[model samples]
Target: MSAAGQTTVPFTVPSFAGEVSDAVVKVLDSGWVTTGPQTAAFEQDFADFLGAAHVVAVASCTTALELCLRAMDLPPGSAVLTPSLTFCGAINAILHAGHRPVLVDIDEDTLVPSPETVAAAAARTRPAAMVVQNQGGYPVDVAALTEAAGLDRTRVVEDAAHGPGAARDGAPVGSSSYAACFSFYATKNMPIGEGGAVATSDPDFADRVRAMRLHGMSKDSWKRYLPGGSWRYDVKSIGLKANMTDIQASIGRAQLAALPGWQRTRGELVARYDAALADLPGLVLPQRDLAGVQHAWHLYQVRVPDRDALIAELEAAGVATSVHFIPASHMTSYRAVLGEEECGRVPVTDRVAEELLSLPLYPGLSPDGQDRVVTALTGALRARS
Candidate 1:
């Protein structure tokens, strides 16, 4: 018995009040809001927080990815191996940088590409780079991928969009990767409304990324504004305008300040959801495998039978839901590029597309809200049964 015209429980939302508001007020009072001291502090603090050697903040993850690709200066039409089950931005970044995206399938449960798949794709294409995604905050087997690709020929560009506090094995996400991109989009665990960063251990690569992120300028505006700073700067190359502003960084700084506590709450909430939904029929919980790895828990997506109808039922009962993605090849534009034969080859990603569903999971998601979600899901599953 699915009800009609039901209320909506938003899938994800930023719950910021105290520190975020305070930071914003201070930024307003200071009157130097566009990429100033706060932005620099946030960038430095974020790099320190993640234990990465360099961090360059950008307007969005797409920008961050694009800048990194451009910084690499791969030959035109160079292929970059990436999971097919990812946001279009990943693919777009490839095209924007005058390269081709070599889409690959993902593991069934993890929803991330396997190193074996990466190797097979690389062998087929001799890729210049591999963009691995930490799908749903589940860390990919980076070590395995590195071993397969070797150090010289393959460069890894990690789309750590869902991995802020996430880890692989014992290493924190973005600690020392070839190049890692993180998103602070409004829906992410650490929302800055619209901002992202690229992290890397290679100082030279980081410097290139910095140059490309802000009009290819020789120096950032902060350099010009600091004491004994010069006003003149040179434009080294043609770059996009994709710098993070202090206004957004103010919120990011606050969010970064509270990330650990937020992660703990998310973990607890996921455990609660797991315990409640464990035995429910027609539902498959997301999997976790790394023994010592930490998950940021950015999303708590699950798979279910007849996902569309279940989503309707959940909405009818005041629980919101979302799909992680519709496979990239399914889109009309990419369909032409990959062709039907190639698209059908990604069996794992194709299967998950029919059933993936994201539940409401955020720091301020109340216990009562979670209980309502579980109850609604239980009822929906029973009704479907």
Candidate 2:
């Protein structure tokens, strides 16, 4: 049973069956499955795609965020400004790096922190660094945000978990920041199951992340286990086990090659959604193609009335949906950190958290599937009204 009377439309389905499968099998047969040649190749390919100076593949985006913050070498308990309306990983990374997380509110339309808000928070907190997220794969104005934070580009990190092929002002997302972290989770825009990368133009920062992704060893295991490798190595600093496996990199290489086509398909799907749902009452569509930037169209989120009831209605109709976030300020752990007064500061975040709904949007999502989602949503909204 489905919204259109058959086959449920899923929230997300990774588009990897042919070439991706072949690539993974090839890696399995190669016998070197750790952070070896495949991982190196994937990193190089991704860097070339972004025109970035360096890129380091890691175990997950969470690890990449932590790695970037640790590379900053900030003092313990230093303030780090981040958005309240974002995935938990962003705030968690700030706390994990021995920094205090200062939650900022987001813009109502874009669901991203505005430059003015960031500037105001930076002035109040005098934060050592700022973590700006490209919420739902929409590229944020990093240059403006950096200027607002009153810090150089080096102190800004782009949490690009929803951005892989996204660009801003004729440049890739990672090209103009201190570091941009990408996710290749099962449901993210780029799917390699569980992997991520940190892209940066700074050679020194890239070097630090490369070393820190492993065990802070002077030489990586790939170098130590090679034919002419030496067993002798030196430890520099404490690090984490966040290196990406060659198997994951193998799949990522295939996905990276196909990213352009996949992005095109997503854009087409988004266009269809926009055209069909534009006039629906009590529903606000997500922002699209602001100024000169390209939106990655990773999530087709909409703000609707009776959000929970609409989700249930769609679920009964066989269309799976989800919420992008719960607003970090509302979470118990973040509430404890942000206290009561600060928690009530994010009015927009609080409202949007209750209204936002992510519909089905992915490369594999068929037009018929999208139509079903739209129909179900329309019916739900009308019924609620």
Which one is best on TM-score? 2
The 10-residue segment of model 1 with minimum total lDDT is 146-155
Task: Note the Cα lDDT for every prediction shown.
Answer: 0.85, 0.89
Candidate 1 per-residue C-alpha lDDT over 6-45 given as tens digits, one digit per residue, 9 for 90 to 100:
5556787786746898899999999888877888789899
Highest lDDT: give the candidate number: 2
Q: Which portions of model 2 show Cα errors greater than 4 Å?
A: 1-6
Q: Per model, how many backbone clashes are there? A: 1, 0
- What TM-score would every model get versus the actual structure? 0.95, 0.97
Name every residue pair that clashes in candidate 1: 35-246
Residue 229 C-alpha lDDT in model 1: 94
Kindly give the stretch of ten consecutive residues in candidate 2 with the minimal lDDT sum. Answer: 1-10
**What is candidate 1's CA lDDT for residue 341?**
75
Candidate 1, RMSD to the unseen true structure:
2.0
For residues 193-269, what per-residue lDDT tens digits would candidate 2 score against the true structure?
99999999899999899999997888898899999999998878778899999999999999888889899999999
